[model samples]
Target: MNFRIPIFSLLMIGFSQSAFAQIKEEQLILDRKREPEIKKIEKKKTSVEAEKNYPPREKKIEDSLNLRYTVTDVPAASDFKTSTIQGEDISPKFEAENLNNYFQLGMGNFGRILADGNIGTKLENEIEVGADFHVLSTSGLKKEYPWSSKQNIGNVAAYLNANGEKGKFNVIADYGLNDYNLYGIYALQPDADTDLKQRTNRFKVNGYYDFYSNEILNNVRLKTSFLGDHFNAKESQAEIRVNLSKHGVELPVGNDVVLNADLGLNLETLNTDFAILQENSSKFLNATVAPQVTFFNGDSYLMLGSDFSFLNAKNSTANTDQVQENRTYWFPKAELQFAAADEFKFYAGVTGGLQLNSFANLLETNPYLLSDQQLRPTETKYKGYVGLRGDIDQQIKYDFRAGFGKINDMVFFRANDLFDTSVSGNRAAYDYANSFSAVYDNGKVSEVKASVQYFPLANLTLDAEAQFTKYDLENYEHIYNVPLLKAGIGAKYSMLNKKLHLGANAIFSTDLTTNSFEITESGSQPNVFISTENNDDKVGGYADLNLSAEYRVHKNFSIFALGNNLLNSNYQTFKGYKVLGAQILGGVKISF
Candidate 1:
């Protein structure tokens, strides 16, 4: 027990010494942090002690452990502020006005009058229906002649269209009437007025049905027409057509391709009473099949196809048991197109087809035809062509084509008595040699065509085109009424906030061969006639210029003026038919 007390006392002494050492180290750390303040405090103490002359006292444990801290000042922040914002006002929208219905009226010199109008409406389910009418007439011209030069034409049409999902269709019905006096050839009969005045009527119905996303069968077309003149010349026809297309068609040596075919059937009946032709009426039945295949590669495509057709013809007035004429044809429709760039292409192709001719078509080509004219089909044996189509730049585009064609049964217009001038004639209204006759011949034609379109400005467009054709007729002395060169220039411009529109076009045609005949009295009692032919005689070689302008005075009203034959010269359209002087017409147009 005595030994333990000494050991315990010794341990307690060591622990007290360790604790005192730690407290002293903490005081030293405080003195180092504020050494200047501590020195000042010590100096003040010494001064006080010296002034009072008092003895120094020993410092205790509390004095050694005392600590002090300094506090720093911080500035205050300002108040928060924000500005208010206002929203902009929105403009009201108005619905657009309907301008589908329109009308036009005009009057001008040479006793001209024009009137036309149209009205239409949109029905439910994407359907549209409309009707329109047109009328034009001219009354006074060439008073010095014994005959009257008067013309009148009128037309009316109605249409219905429907657009559906993956399919669409349209149907149209129209009628036209044209009345005029054949004053170019004056009649020798005392009452020629009754024979000279004639009228033509035209009626037609056309329809089309199409499928947008169809793969096998895509489109169908139907047409019916009846056209006739006062001279018992009439043509009535009905036709139906369908298009078949298929994609992803498998091939033996290559990938899938596309196949397309077009099938058609047509029937026609015609009638004509001629002074010379023994058979003046006919009937026709035509069937056609066109099939094509398209092979595609990298920027290149080849379309190979052929058109095959069968035609049957018979005399309209003949007995039902009569044998009909049967004809068959095959035409190539092949082309290879290579795209050199995005906007340019080079293509070469061969095409040929048969065109059926009728009195209506002949009348359109030559208005003066004998009623007893024979009708025949024009056969295009072959037409080979090479073409380049591309855009020059952003604003200009161009197309150039050169082709050669061989045609059979090409029709030409010739004077009535051009070949035969026998004194004894039918003495009919058209037998006076003043009328024209249709002549057919086989010929070869080489042609080159070029066209360019330039959009110089946003609202202006300029177009120019030229065509040159060289004809080769074997054994025929002349190719009548065929122009060697044809060209035209047209321009359309809109200005003044797009309220004024101006259009101008000029057409130029080269000289053509025409038959010139002269009549001479060879007898005193019978007044026998002798006709002479001028083989080198020619007609045409004129530039026809026309200009039109329209100014929209209001949203629904416009003022328009047009000047035709602006050169102020006589324009001969046919061999003996000449148009009046420069015609000026002014009118108003309305939109509702």
Candidate 2:
């Protein structure tokens, strides 16, 4: 599950600008004339440089001591079920059972693990190596009872840095795996006979270098990365991205001052056995580039950028099934910060883009498995957005955004009725002998969001956010009228000399518009049309409540107890997805 943690700096900039606007008009005019003088005064009134640079500092070595283990049973509605079509006396049934039982073992400081501190050890020639890893797991399935599943996730990363006297360079790599297994649940079949499994892996490696050493071009940086993944198919995809960027350039470009540019090129390829089955499995290759230019004033900035992507994909799956897609995108991104007062700032930006996907990859892995399919691998889209954000005070800030977009030839999975088995002329009906289809359609989507953060005390903070999204399909066969909204609030407190930490987060989500699923025929044959008008009417949200206490017994030995899902709240963030309720576990650690 992905959680959106409201960004803090984006709000501070807006708030700082707003506060500066409160200055009197006369002061503004005089301030402009006295800008240089004010700058000189500021420089002269500064604290001692040596003292400022050598301020008090904290040591890094720490350890975790002690441990705790806690588990609980949760109650909720199940999202997955097995049913038979052909008018068989098959109906979806929900079995009541405990969902989620997991233990969290905290080693050393929770914050240290959460922050993922980089361990850099000096090697020969100013070279260094850094590594980091995090793992979290939960067991025992609850809610959508009967069909139980086990969930696990972990991330590992390592990097090597070479900082030479002339310049700096680095190479880094990361690997992540997420998997889920459902046991004793019969899917796509009748009877609790067989179980299903799903797994996904993502990995990437990147290389970067700073070309200039001691010049204005020192702000210029160039880097490239190779990213690969195997999510839908067993095959892996490899892509390369090369970027050229320059920042903090104080120069004039025509009438606009302070200009910068960022440009990048991306090349990608996919190697898989599915390509052999679909015949469309040719050496997949493509290239894309995005270039951006920005003009900045003392308090405002404007940006223009565009992305051009091209792809060459082949599917030899007879006629019509041979797939290929090429795409291009044009976008304009801009932002302007207006300081309306000395202590307040109001800022907003409008951004949108147009994209054309001439080639679409719809078939999962191998297309040859099916004898007939009718999906055109091409699409076009348009999108745009507007948002405002800023700080109300030093301790409070907020942001909101709204956007609209439309996608033409939007690919969708299409299915047919199993009984209508007239195979001729129908590619999907003849080949799969099933009633499912994936096609493209034209659709529009809109989204809105607002979030705020407030620090009530020096060591305590509160945050709340809301998001609403809507999707309108112009020509869809399987479903229609899909709209969803989400809202959430969370709080964090720092205690025990900032060593012990406690936080709680709650997220609420619901569908405003109803979606219809085609019901399957019962008994002999499966009904292809499963429709739902009122939806599941979900009303509850997931809560992430955790408390961790760490005590520094000595300079290098620290003990702590960490609790995750403290309340053991039982809820699912997505339909059919089960999350562990609560777990409390702790462990000791020795640190350098």
Candidate 3:
């Protein structure tokens, strides 16, 4: 009975304990479910509180302002104590020197003598006057050749120049006399001791005037000349030239046009008488009018012009033969120029004209010509040329030119024939080997020329020139006495503060064709029966070398020495002629 009661208490206690465990399990499940909802609500409340505590902030700005500044007045200048400093003098000093007049005298081998004098003066109003005189004489080298060779030459010249507000004026007068003996025939006629004397005199007067006005006519020139020989041959010429020119005529192409006109009048007369040849007289009247137009810019230029000439000539001889010619000729001249750079230029031209071949000109070219030569005018039909000139580095200069021309009645020198038996020795009187006769030939000529100048230093200079000429004759087989090639070179040097100067020059020429003759005697009067056979000869090429040196001893005094033909080459410039060998001259010069 007691066992039943204990069992019931145990059962009830166990049941209660089971019910409490069940209740605890249910609460744990409910807490797990409500944890997420509680956390969500707390997070929402924290975000709202944070937003309310820290509201949206306003934007901030920075302030920048400039400060004002006041400038003070500058301090007034103050006066300091007067002061002076003295030092050694350092100024430029100059010496005055005058060397307008000079006198020179010299003597050398072969009995040669030289004398020269020059004087010049300047006056108020820009007037200048000057005079010059020179004399050169040489006697024979050998006594046996007394009549073989002798020479005397003298010249005098004076000039006057004046400059005024209007323009310039100049007058010049000159006279020259030359005397020489014919010695070319001495080798053939050694026993015949006859002195053949020849003398020539020339006189000239020239006047020039230039006007500074703005008119077209600007310049005028007048010239008169007279030439005479020992054989009663006389020639006179008078010429007048007037120029009209206008410059700076603007053109549409930004160039300038120059219009120029030239008017010239010339009158010439010649008279001569020979023992064997008849007397001859010639008169010529020449008038020319030339008009030209030039278009020029700074770098290029072109010139176009034409010359119209009216010539009237009359030639008469003692044999009642007369020739008269009156003609009008037209010559066209044109030139083109271009400057490629500052130191280079190219130029070309085509020109043609008639040149007067007067007796004075002939005598000047060949002093040994006989007085009985005929006179005529030379006609150049056409001449065309192109040339280039330039400088290199401002120290050297060069020029090259090539040209072709056709000439009618070109004159050349030829030996005369003296063997005519009918002249009764009259032909021999004037037919010496030294004498030359003028001959005419029509031909075409071509020439090439080149020149160069170099300055290696401030006081040294050198120059060289070369030329080649070719001729195609129409009627003749050869051109007589004309060299095919010519060349020259010269150099000058100064040193010792310009107190010492030296100069040297050399010239070369090719061989020339000339006529010679062989002497023959017939079986009769030996003196009167001389005859000659024609033969051809050649004058060999020649070179001439000359040197000079000078040293200044004082401010107005100097000593100089010169040597010619230093190589002693026995070369002849003309057929049957002999030139002097080495010759030396030394002298002193005084200037004041």
Candidate 4:
């Protein structure tokens, strides 16, 4: 989804596993039920529209995702999860009452190979078991880029779910592997060896149970994960969440009220062999208890809550060189919903919390990040917002929201030092300033977002969304690599009695910024600092236009094709990285 220096001395620079060792890490993936990136794929699920909307599995129904789409997301996030230009929503909710199986195989230019499928079966004791998998690999952009390398990325998982009058439970495990080159404009060496590679993988387990009989333990979620690379850099993390609620209790007030509480525990430990300066190793943990009460009369409702948490972290370069850092925090939470009209509503809320920043998580966004550079957790001091949404008759729906917040330890990235210690030293395949390192800064942010959906005709769907953010930092001229303005617009049309589907998507983001570094040594000593005025570089923004088509050959089969970067973009997603361009994939889908 993301270089090789040919001059690399493979034998002399083979990554060292002899450094201080950190244990392994595991991961857990929880998919929310949302529309797939490809809307046509949803209709392809079944000939009957009713089955298209999966029968409810959990007793609780999540809010429908059809109203509005969440646009691009913050780059500083631990999970780096945000909607892309495609605006597709993907979450694994495998507990549907009726499960169908399908298999897809595709091939395209640039050696692109895509395969995805899911299999499930009903078991005794009201239990269900299934497996889902998707994998894609592409030849590097060497055809046009001359310097890019091929990439292979994908994931697969197995799950077991059961439900009854008492409750429901599910257990899942998954693993993912990504292999790519770190060919940066600056990292390239005359003798660079593109054949040498960097590989990363993660393994995880997730378990969840919802209870109907026990009020104290109504919902429990548990997960543990491990992430590491070929060099032995690793992160181990575990999490637990529980929700308890009391409903329909008679109170002194007129309307019946519900009391609820949530408990959470998250912990992680990481070790990334060595940075340019020091070995990186650290641990982070957060425990929190939140309680709230809600009262509703008619269509109007109100709720209030408070979150209290204790945060702890231990960071250092050596086993004995660590000091445990601890702090306690309290945040306010509240929301109000009013019936502005029978079909329209107005709502507002106040929310804030601590965001865990870990290498295991950050890698999702910037896979080119160095193996080790310990970073502090980013804290959201506070954020307040309001919004209103409704429909124009039966064909159109809209949503809007705006908010302002202050952040502590806001994180951003910059190029690594091209040369070791001010212009000299052996470098890893990724260290040529082509790779990014995390930097911490504090700042205030303001943002506004809006999205709309129109179904003018039964077979035609129109969607568009946009978001803009302003960052005012205390220590940087600009927030490098994070998008300041982003937007997406798409259209999907069905013809030939719904058997033929056509779609187009246009995803855009403003130009991104990057800061370079130069080292000058005074005699034998060296110093490190950014010279923003002279080193700042701009990476041009892009309009990634894509088109897709699919034809249902029969109730159990279909054929499809996808065209990416139809504009043959030369823009870079990162400072020096170029995206694969003008490629098409054709495939067949079979259902059983």
Candidate closest to the true structure, highest TM-score: 4
lDDT of 1 by residue, 141-176 (tens): 555345566778777777776666556667778887
Estimated TM-score per prediction?
0.76, 0.61, 0.79, 0.80
Runs in model 1 deviating more than 4 A are 1-98, 186-195, 248-279, 297-299, 315-323, 418-428
What's the lDDT for all of these models?
A: 0.59, 0.40, 0.61, 0.60
Could you tell me which 10 consecutive residues in candidate 2 have the lowest summed lDDT? 61-70
2 versus 4: better TM-score goes to:
4
Shift of residue 498 alpha carbon in model 1, Å: 1.0
Query: Which scores better on lDDT, 2 or 3?
Result: 3
**Backbone clashes, candidate 2:** 63
RMSD of 4: 11.9
**How well is each residue in 281-315 modelled by candidate 2, as lDDT tens digits?**
33356666778776655444566676665656554
Q: Roughly what TM-score does model 4 have, to 2 decimal places?
A: 0.80
lDDT of 3 by residue, 283-305 (tens): 77888777777665655667788
Misplaced by over 4 Å in model 2 are 1-120, 142-148, 182-193, 210-232, 245-256, 270-284, 315-321, 325-329, 333-381, 408-441, 477-483, 512-570, 573-575
* Residue-level lDDT tens digits of model 4 in 73-115: 2111111112221111122122112228888787777787777
